[model samples]
Target: MEVPDLRSLRAADTPVVGGKAAGLGELTAIGLPVPPGVVLPARFLNGNDERALADLLPGLVRERGVRPPFAVRSSALCEDGEHASFAGQFHSELEVDEAGLAGAVVRCARSADAKNVQHYADALGVAPGLSGQHSVSVIVQEQVAADLSGVLFTADPLTGDPDTYVLEVVPGPGSALVGGTTEPLALRLGSDGVVVTTRPDWCDESFEARVLGLCLRLRELGRSVTEHRGSPQDIEFCTTADDTVVPVQARPITSLPALSARSFDLTFTPVCHATSDELGALARLDKVRLRLVAESCGLRVGRAWIIRAQASGSPRQEEPTALPPGLSDAPQISFVLQDPARLGGSIVRRFSAVGSRSHDLRETVQLVGASHDRFALIATEIHDAELSGVARRFGDHVVAEVGFGAFVPKGVVATSQYVCTTDGTIEHTEPVRQERAFLIEQGMPRAVTIGRTPTLTPEQCRMVCQAVEVANQYHTRPSVEFGVERDGSLFLIDFVEDGADDAGPRPEDLGIISSGRLAGRVVRVDDDRALELASLDSHFHTDRPGAAPAAVHDPVIVVAALPYLSLESFIRERDATSLGFVFRNCSYLSHLSIVLRELGVPALVDRQAYDRLRADDHVLLDTADRTVAQVPEAESTP
Candidate 1:
């Protein structure tokens, strides 16, 4: 057959135009937003067809005003089937003009015999047909410049939930994602709602909202395609600057895992009311007032119920104090705080365990107040609240509590330092995107990327505002620490007695994490976990193996929070290149600091410097000069 316009073709034309083209043809015929294109048959590529198409190729560049700058892609006969995908194994030339179409088509056709194609076919158990024998048609279609592009799986591959779909999106061309240099913003969407698996640094509420809408649309589109194609499909799509989602390709998922779910008891029991005496186990707070204020904003107030030896944590201690009958013995949630009051160098003890099964509860484990120091919020299963001693457990003071709570499992969480005014207006210290955190799964914490993180919704923020107002009533400019759930549920972790000194600008005139002298644009990795930034010199570390590997050569400051052993390569990679580094949050005594000193390139590890810079932002960061200034974008040009 001769070159077939996309709309003129159908599913029956797979032998000539191949699956990718036929699929696009079907989508176009069914009124989808696929860029218009025409396909040259596989016979031409495999040398069984005519060469005269080249003379006609430039004339067919525009299929009715759908002009070049076209994208020429491979659509082999053996590809896009239920058994094999051949994804990224073939060639795709983007942004080609009419004059370049003939050459691009030749390149894509020749790639059918590339070694990578053979290797992929062999791995997939396909018979040796990838040599000079594979049939790969060429598709020249309008290339849509995307604001965001990604891949969407119609079913949850991780949990095997057909009802759930996953979308991974990047800021610019989808090639960046394939390049392994950037992590895409991931979303889990179902009939219920959208859950942001990973939030990209640039992803704010508005960006998230737009993506959610696009995801729902894609879901509808996928359903339509699946109905026609007869299986759950993997779709590659792009959202243009105009917010139009164009489906470039779709194919049936070949090896979707079976449904498997992890069971962990991270649920909370009902609220148990208690008198001020029982609540007094927690330090220095009006528990009765806290309960009223916190519960009003839907925050569970955790209070410990002191026990003497073998006392079961049950009720009979006032209204709404009913205890759970079959509570597990494990501490489902643990927040170990060093009590901000113990400032000087001292022994320092646990803040308190509301649901801890530990026989040795701290002398005073209070859960309410400002905590600027480190704290552990663990979630597992709740058990008995048994304590060995009430007064004489070799203690400074006696305390108890009947409480169990879980924080929003670690991921990309937005933290804001703000002061709530008497009128309930909040002066934000700015929402600082934290580093990759230890997300607890099955009671075990593992360091993961942003995809495991949750975006704080507006409702959650409103509740925080309300909770802060309550704290404001008790203390001057009181701040509240809250654990936000994946579903945007809020829990009042604690009401801080100390937070944001009038919520003013952090004294930038002091405090630097590391010291070096250099200037460059900043590329924020958003993965704040230090152990992960070890190879800052040569590569932009992200999850997943990239389809294309690259090393850093541009003069840019790499920003990350965590630095691990693999980071030593940063020195070698940065040696003669335009690479600088910044520690978003780190300590001077850390290994990353040592690397910073040894790093011949310019480097700064100041939180302020990190906060001042953004992705691709021209900057001049110097420790010796103690300056973090923005350089003009034009100045960064060679």
Candidate 2:
């Protein structure tokens, strides 16, 4: 029941006075210029005591000769958190006199139950309640009689770049700006300089200079508030007729981008770029799956490492962080393949003018077969999706569109290919700009021109080279595919190994297995012969003396008679990265096909397909088509 002065409270008083009053209190406590205010604590707001609310007027009027005209605003206890901003959702009454202060406070308290507030809260999946009751505190403050008002975001709200500060200023008080009624001057200030993105016709040279000066002065003030709050802030501020800037409110930037430790940085160097000679040195550590080889040599599978979620009886996590697999991502270590493959590449851009609009981000995600209500926002506003998997492609460059990488091979966008050097430097062809992007209408992806200008930036081009350098700077000479995010962050989508070096046979000469599921080196295991532990006839094996295989070794496709009950244990052992099988005939459950299917390993039935394959010869297998084809030796790296 403590109805205290706003200056007497701090940010920790949120549960009592709510987020708005607590923010003002924090600013006031630290000697930052804030409009004087007093808070009617949440518990007192619910007390239904008309007499106790009477102190609000005297407090508003006693603010160092401040006058009768005031602002009464709702400050819900959960108003501003990291996840939801709740901006403009509640009520605010400006220019209220002493006679109307009582009514304004009542309206402010009742705004918590308003339809817009309820709907906005429900969308973010958190109720602003304490102990089963939706709690709200009322803030009666000395309204600033200002020459100009605006909002300042300490960081770039769109891209989450901490180095940028965005200031949006209107000619008068901020109500018109926040209510979406007026066009404001939008200035983006970074360490480099100031850039005005939006300037109204009336904003001339001197007016623009004053606004820019105010923005520069607020830099340290904004930084101080952010440091004190332990996060970037979205602040409401006004410039007085005397040219002094005063902060009116502060709140944590909801939807601030929080990237994890596996952050894909542009300056990152790969684990190792194993040229052909280095690949031979790695023969002692043979793991035939290209994904495994890439990782062993310090190559990332995609732009960033992807982890899978597990189903269980434990508590659910808000984000994915474990290494359990199913169909969504890769279930086991796998290889890439392309028919008639070339040493060319393509830049797979998903979002058009990313960081420009929310719909563009939605459309970008829709192309990748991902959709959610969270992605819905205004055409020009882009918000962060705290944790996300932007784009993933499992297609071996067969078809050019798919939702997610399915059991079948497919891509997410239409793109033209470019040729690159062994070190992943773009050489012959200039990358094409995607003419159109796809948006999800109903349940299907439809081509649209809404998000265009989706070309790669120079920074994005450099990131692609870096991503590809680590992934394919090896003997494979793989055709690399990359995804450029909406914020211009680049990710290496996949690498398609044609299994051909410059001196080897063209990929098509190796024969066709319809399309491929994954690739592995051939090691024909007949029904009677026990598998050898030694590396053999292929470059993948070292023949290192005294080397013994363990429960977790490299993968090899066994070509022999149908799987029997005795071979089940050997096939199921964890010793191999992931074992595959090739039999002469096919059946669903009669042979070991059921187990192989359950384990998500490659299995096929075709006798003639083995004619072109031999021990240690690399091959791509299509389990559904029941065939396998030899792949030529991979090329050398940089």
TM-score, one value per model: 0.40, 0.41
Q: Candidate 2 versus the native: TM-score? A: 0.41
Error of 2 at 357 (Å): 39
Candidate 1, TM-score vs. the true structure? 0.40
Per-residue alpha-carbon lDDT of candidate 2 for residues 1-638, written as tens digits (9 for 90 to 100)? 26676766665567788888878876653356677767776677677555555665565457434466888888887787667778888888999987777778878888877888778878887755443324778887788888999898988988877679898898889998888898889998888998999999878888888888876567767766675565789988888998778888899888777532221111111113334443332222212233444556543333111111122232222232222122113212211111111111211122223222223332232222111111111111111211111111112211111111111012122233222333334333322333344332222234445222233444444444554455444534443444443464543334544332222112221122122265666766442311110000010111111111135445566765434322444453444335666654332222233345445666665657645567777776765454576765451000
What overall lDDT, based on C-alpha atoms, would model 1 receive against the true structure? 0.53
Across residues 416-488, which tens digit of lDDT does each residue of candidate 1 receive? 2222332333322223344334333333334444422223334444555566556666665433445544344
